[model samples]
Target: MAAGTYQNWRDVADLAMDAIAKDPDAWGDAGAGKNCRSRLIYLYNRRTGQLVRTQIVIQLSAHQSGKSNRIITAYPRGHQC
Candidate 1:
């Protein structure tokens, strides 16, 4: 899960789910995980529906042994490299 105020967002969970449903825009080898998937998703605040935040969801990799892929983190897109 994302740290700071992102966790408190009303649609934080939804954003993560959406990311999994969408095709990753970019990816790379994340070492032990085999690969990393980066997707863009939007999170909205509960009180204000107009409040939208763009986040990048990095999934560790596809399932292996029936286990689902794990999300490394979600952070504001374009805010960092």
Candidate 2:
């Protein structure tokens, strides 16, 4: 996936982790599937230099034994929730 305004994959991961850590309740149904989850977070856009609503999606590995959860995608969704 394209990093877009993000510096790199690590940058996106760090922001997503921080958001989840700060407010666990922010995550909700992503509707991608049973194992997928999504969260809307306000994050700093390095290009815009503004705080924007970003969407972070993660897929749980519940169906895959011994696998870990992984982020599926992250992007700026503007002000929409």
Candidate 3:
């Protein structure tokens, strides 16, 4: 993996913080204190040359059934998805 790649678990945790700071509403019921896992998604827009980094969090539930998972989302400097 490349340096600063989001594929790793630690990077995901670090990016989650940035996501929290970028958009708190996407956090849903899971606040920063809650146990969560995140994935980093990159986007490109016509208006800008740089790519936008987005963080998506999967809300951990105790009674989650198979395929029935809870997820929370957060984005940085762009429209909420």
What are the runs in model 2 whose C-alpha is more than 4 Å off?
26-38, 50-53, 59-81
- lDDT of residue 9 for candidate 1: 44
Question: Clashing residue pairs in candidate 3, if any?
Answer: none
| Candidate 2 lDDT by residue in tens digits, 1-81 | 224556676777666655654554434444444233335655566787776545654423232343335554444433222
Please, what are the lDDT tens digits per residue for candidate 3 over residues 48-70? 54554444443332224433233
Flag the better candidate by lDDT, 1 or 3: 1
For each candidate in turn, the TM-score is 0.50, 0.41, 0.28
lDDT of each prediction vs. the true structure? Answer: 0.56, 0.48, 0.40
Question: Which wins on lDDT, candidate 2 or candidate 3?
Answer: 2
Worst 10 residues of 2 by lDDT: 59-68
Best by TM-score: 1
Name the runs in model 1 displaced over 4 angstroms: 1-14, 62-81
Pairwise TM-score winner, candidates 2 and 3: 2
lDDT of 1 by residue, 22-61 (tens): 7677766656645566677665554555445567666555
Instruction: Output the number of the lDDT-best candidate.
Output: 1
Output the TM-score of candidate 3.
0.28
